[model samples]
Target: MQLNQRINAFVELGKLLKDLAENETIAQTILAKAEAENGWFTRENILFSLNNWAEALTQANLLQWMSKYNVELLPQESNEVKKVAIIMAGNIPLVGFHDFLSVLMTGNKVITKLSSNDKTLLPFIAAQLIEIEPRFKDYVAFTEGKLEHFDMVIATGSNNTARYFEYYFGKYPNIIRKNRNSVAILNGTETEAELKLLADDIFVYFGLGCRNVSKLYVPEGYNFEAFFKAMYHWKEIIHNHKYINNYDYNKAVYLMDSFPLLDNEFMLLKEDKGFSSPISVVFFEKYDSEESLKKEVSKHSENIQCIVSKIGIDNEIRFGETQFPKLWDYADGVDTVAFLLDS
Candidate 1:
């Protein structure tokens, strides 16, 4: 299929996903299956992620994203269709959708090794796409066992697993992503509304995705009163047994160790220099100077994903916008579309 045909099929699939949100009966059924497979895949979180994808898949958005590349030449330049193998990370629902979309958008075949945690949602959506345009049947495949016979690869996993990916797939052209966490820089001037929105950046998808802000860089004398008060918006998140269990466990461990912690009966804020915090906690550190903070952040740029700030930091992602990334917001700053097209 041509690029436009592929884009049209996805556009139709987007409509189906958006419509599914309105059809509570169908949406609930899908959510139930996802929850059964993974306890972290709560109905609300799945629906939130689905809605974001639906909104992003518009014709105008797809066309605009494609306009950045010489997409029309894909079919003309290559006689052999490259079979791209994708190892998806299931930290959040449909986490690997972007890679899947990139492969097919470039007129290449995709063979996905689905994560056991997120096995249901993507396949169901892929089925819907095939129904929208049957030509996808020739391009899409999912394997339950070891992957073989692929021309290129795209893999996402923790830093440990990334080493294995590089060791094994190093011979092939690939984009391998490791662990990354987002952080927010608070200058102590944010309004309550902005802080409330920041709550979504921290709590949405239960803070499983890399884009979720797991750390904060606050002014040296910043007070926790306002930040804690604004975090009340996601108090309902504590009601989830899985989340509460982590919160209780982490809180107990910290208390036992006599580590300083700020608790709000739901989330815990700890003074830490780390990027990846425990699920029920957010790590934070105080900064005395903008120059030092910028230098420090730049030093760890490899481990940082999104910098949630409105303080004029270069390439900073605004509050509540990290999770709503557009089609072209490639993870790890690696251009998936360019990678696929070049491969």
Candidate 2:
């Protein structure tokens, strides 16, 4: 397919997703399949993911994002179509969609080894794409067994699996992403509305996504009453059995160890210096000065995916925009498109 053809097909697919989000029957159908496949994919969350993608895949956004790259400079016809195998992560709904889109948009064939936890949604979307543009049928494939006959690979996994990926696929041109988490910086001046929005950053996807804020950096003697009050808006998430179960387990561990914690009935807050927090838990640390905080964040840059703040730190994502990454907002700060195009 030509580059324009590929871009148009995705834009159409996005429009279809938006239509599905508003169509009760089709939305229910997709939601039912997702729920049956993965219990964690509640209808609300599934639709949220779908709507976000719909917003992201618009023709305008597509054009604007691609405009930054010199698409015309890319090889019009490659001597050999390289196969880029994508090992997806299932931590959140459609977490690997960006990589899949990147590979296809770059004129490479994609062999997706879908994570079992999220195997249904992407393939369904891919079917829609193929239906819209038959040429896509020749470019996309899914795998169940071991990946083979691929020229390059892009893998997303935890820190442990990343080691295995490096040991195995190290010879191939690859982007092996390891575990990373986001954090928020609070200067005690945020309004209740801003803090409320920050709740979405922390609670969305039940905090399973890398963009979810797992930790907070606050000034010394920062008050918690306002933050907790704002977080109450998402209190209904406690009704989720899985989330409550995790809350119960982690809370019990902390209690048994006599570790001090602040609880809001649904989530637990602990004072610690850690980037990766358990589900239903968030860790916070006190910073003495802005310079020290920046130094600390920079020191742990490899473990951090994004920094959410209103203090105007360099590259800090806006208060609530952590999860809504633009197409060019490459994962792990690595340009997947550039990698694929160069390969």
CA lDDT of every candidate: 0.92, 0.91
- Candidate 1, run of 10 with poorest lDDT: 71-80
Q: Which stretches of candidate 2 lie over 4 Å from their true place?
A: none
lDDT of 1 by residue, 217-306 (tens): 999889989999999989999999999999999999999999999999999999999999999899999999888999999999999999
Q: All candidates' TM-scores? A: 0.98, 0.98
lDDT of 2 at 247: 98
Q: What is the lDDT of residue 64 in candidate 1?
A: 95
Query: Any residue pairs clashing in model 2, and if so which?
Result: none
Q: By how many angstroms RMSD does model 2 differ from the true structure?
A: 1.1
Estimate the overall C-alpha local distance difference test score of candidate 2.
Answer: 0.91
